[model samples]
Target chain A: MKAVYKRELNSYLNNPMGYVFLGIFVLFFSVIFCYINLYSLVSSNISYTFSYMIYAMLVLMPLLTMRLMSEEKAQKTDQLLLTAPVKASSIILGKFFAAMTLVLLALVFTLPHIVILVIQGNPGFLVTLLAYIGFILYSSVYVSIGIFISSLTENQVISAVLTFAIFMGLLALEILFVPGIQSPTLYKILSGISFASRYSDFSMGVFNLTSLVYYASAAFLFLFFTVRVTEKRRWA
Target chain B: MIEISNLTKSFGKHKVLDNITFRVGEGEVLGFLGANGAGKSTTMNIITGYLSSNEGKVLINGINILEEPEKAKKLIGYLPEQPPLYLNMTVSEYLDFVYQLKGIKLNEKAEKGEKSEKQQHIEEICEMCGITGVYKRLIGNLSKGYRQRVGLAQALIGNPEVLILDEPTVGLDPVQIIEIRNLIRELGKKHTVILSSHILSEVSAICEKVIIIHNGRIAAASVTDKLIKEFQDSNRLRLTAEGDAQELVKTVSVIYGVDSVEIDETKTNSSAAEIIIRTSKDVRGPIMSRLVEKNIGVINFGLDTVSLEDIFLKYVGGESDEGSIQERAE
Candidate 1:
């Protein structure tokens, strides 16, 4: 398992995919920081930068997850992993972690914003930290989304489009969770499923256990589902 | 050692493989021979734990691939129909990644101030595959033959007890084919090798036991010599001589064990004829002495040859409508 993880991580580094993803990601944060943090005379709410950073991930997460499994299936390279002396969970987790690491690498670039705020003026330390947690949670869901869509097709373009559609749908589901609907009980249940509710809670510095469990379990459920999908393919 | 028993695989309503069984002993070379789409790839996939067979099992050294895939897989290395490689990585990096994926706990094997043992293994594999010169080059930039060599090198790494290669030399040049064949022959001394190819000549030349598959069924399986002798044209003797070709033909007919005779149509002369003697017996010894006493000018002689290609075509190609008609009548 360590062997697969090491190799997967190094391939991402050597392939320059890590660089491209990090480059575009840092560029998003910088552009946001310049407009919100640099141009503005008053700099109190720097944590809001991450809310804008969500748009960056809307484009970057698809790029990160697009080639993850689809390329392996396309090149037949998955055979190596499938035939290797390792558990299937290890291979899937190894990929998920590598992609998560790339997103985390992008998340770290926002740290300098907090540092600049500390030097120039006082900012809420807890809110900025909450935003980082939210960033990781949201990207984790995206990783799972990317992997599930990737397993469905061999074409990278199709995988990317499908992942984007899934992310957009999940985002829209959060907005349309009207309390006036038939049953308020079902509305609460449906709202918990939305990634927006999960991330918004974290970004607001309220670490609700339901939101935490929802985000973590949603990622786990999707990863487990992706594994089952790929495993089922061998028979189909 | 590898054992495949009663292996049956079906794709929905289409039965692609039907109760196929074979075994490979250590230090032996086994070849799977068939026409295109003979389920060769499917069989390899099942054995390597890449695909699950619906009604069969593959055991590698007593470990069932389905039940304990990781343990069974550790005993085998498989090169599928296409070399599974990350085109983005260099040759060395790709091998390193493969080595790492195999999980070598070699902290003790690493030397100080040098690359890890994984890197060393990758370098050695690159050297063995003759890709040392291009070790730093991306796999995408390499030619087809180089890609194949890289695939073989991956299979050879970790020194597994069994190597399963599907059409390893499919699109290679003659020299590359011979080189890959020689490598397999060398690897045969220490490991069990099972390679599949539609080309009958390669299987005949490189393998000891040949399994000919047709329509997803085992059509023929035996030693090469036995198969040829059992199916192809009957053995015949050839003798070229200068004489009255008609009388030469008639005289040889009277000899015991002589099945048939024919005179060469490209005549040497009108008065004296050049002839070919065909006999059931490979009797060049007694026939040559008798012919020498008759003053017949002895020229050339040998036994008729049957290539594996001939047998392969007859087996798989027999699925044609005309053959089915003939089979129905029989």
Candidate 2:
């Protein structure tokens, strides 16, 4: 796990893709930060920072996660990782944790906006912390989904395009569910499924355990599916 | 020791390895020979735990690969047809990472690991594979032979007991082929090395025992010398003589120690003929004397010996059967 983690992290940092992802993410965040905190007069709420992140992440998450498995498959490097003396779960988690760490680092860099809020106004840090947790959880879900989608194909372009489509569908699951469903019960269950619905409560200063469980477990499902997908390809 | 019993792999209904069985003793070099698409790589992949066999068992040093893959994989190191390298990394970077992947510790001792002796082993493998000069270079920049060595070096890390390499010498120049063969030979003294190749001479030169696979089944399995001996008579000769072909044939057929003779007039010049001699055992000396005494002046005589190529062709055929997967279920 340590070796996989170290190597993956190093590859990201050493390769140009790392810089591209970090730059795109930071650049977009800074633009939103200036608009939300500086240009606006009453800049007390740091939670608005997250609203900007969603739009950014719709583009940003795929950048980091699209190549996660697709590139490995393309390069035939997955053969090394899969054939090593490591369990399937360890491999899945190792990759998950490494990509999560990168996303966390980028999220951590968003701290300055919150620090300014605290310095200028006595804003609730709890709400801000909850919002940040929501950010990580939400991005992790996308990362796993992207990884799962990446595993389904060898071509990076196809992986990237299909991942975008799947993500758009996840983002719009609510709209698709309506008029088709006749029950309020089904509506609530699926409303609980979207990243926007699950994350909205957290961004509103509420950290719900149900939402937390939903995101974590969904991530696990994707990881599990990713393993099965990879294993299936070996036989195919 | 490596044992593969009743091993079979299939993609859907297509069987790639069909009930193949073989055993390699410790420190033995086993050469896997087949024509292209003969399922050599498929068998190797299953043994290395890279691909699961639809049915069968692979045991390395007494541990089953399927039941306990992690522990079993620890005992074996593999270099696939492609090196499975991260070309973005330097050779040292790739190996250090491989060493760590096998759970070899890099720093302070864990409860149990190979961290203490890790660097020396890495360096030693680097030297053994002749990649020391290119250790600092990115793997992508190295030549095909160097990339192959790096892959070999990765397989050698952590002192694995069994090494499975597929077409290990595929892209090498003649000199590099000899070097890699020598290295494999030297390693065979300590490790059970199993490699596959389509080149017959390479197998004849390196292997003690050879398994010839054709159409996903074992066509022949024997010691290399016996396979050659069965087909080639070492002291046999073919001669063209200035005489009636049938008369020459009748004379040579009666000679002592002459095993069998075939006379052909179609390929002969006027007043001459060609006769192929097969001694019951290697008896070229007696056969030649008898032929000369017949006064059928020997036009030309040349000794013939069956080569590995002939045996391989006879078994695998000139063009290997175009094999395919039947998409069998697991």
Candidate 2 C-alpha lDDT tens digits along B1-330: 899999888777677889999999998888898877779989988897888887889898889987898998988889999999998899999998998889976453434554446667788999999999999999989998899889989999988889898999988999999999999988888889898998889988888888898878998888899988888666578888887887887887787777788865567766789878777665656667887776668878876667888888888666634432221222
Please give the lDDT score at residue A163 for candidate 2.
83
After superposition, the stretches of candidate 1 with alpha carbons farther than 4 Å from their true spots are: A15-17, A34-43, A176-183, B107-123, B229-235, B238-256, B262-282, B285-300, B317-330
> Candidate 2, B95: how far from true, in Å?
0.4
TM-score of each model, in listed order: 0.88, 0.90
User: lDDT score, residue B197, model 2?
Assistant: 92
Fnat of the models, one by one? 0.90, 0.84
**Which stretches of model 2 miss by more than 4 angstroms?**
A175-182, A234-236, B106-116, B239-254, B263-274, B280-283, B290-303, B321-330
How would you class the docking of model 1? Answer: medium
Best by DockQ: 2
Best by TM-score: 2
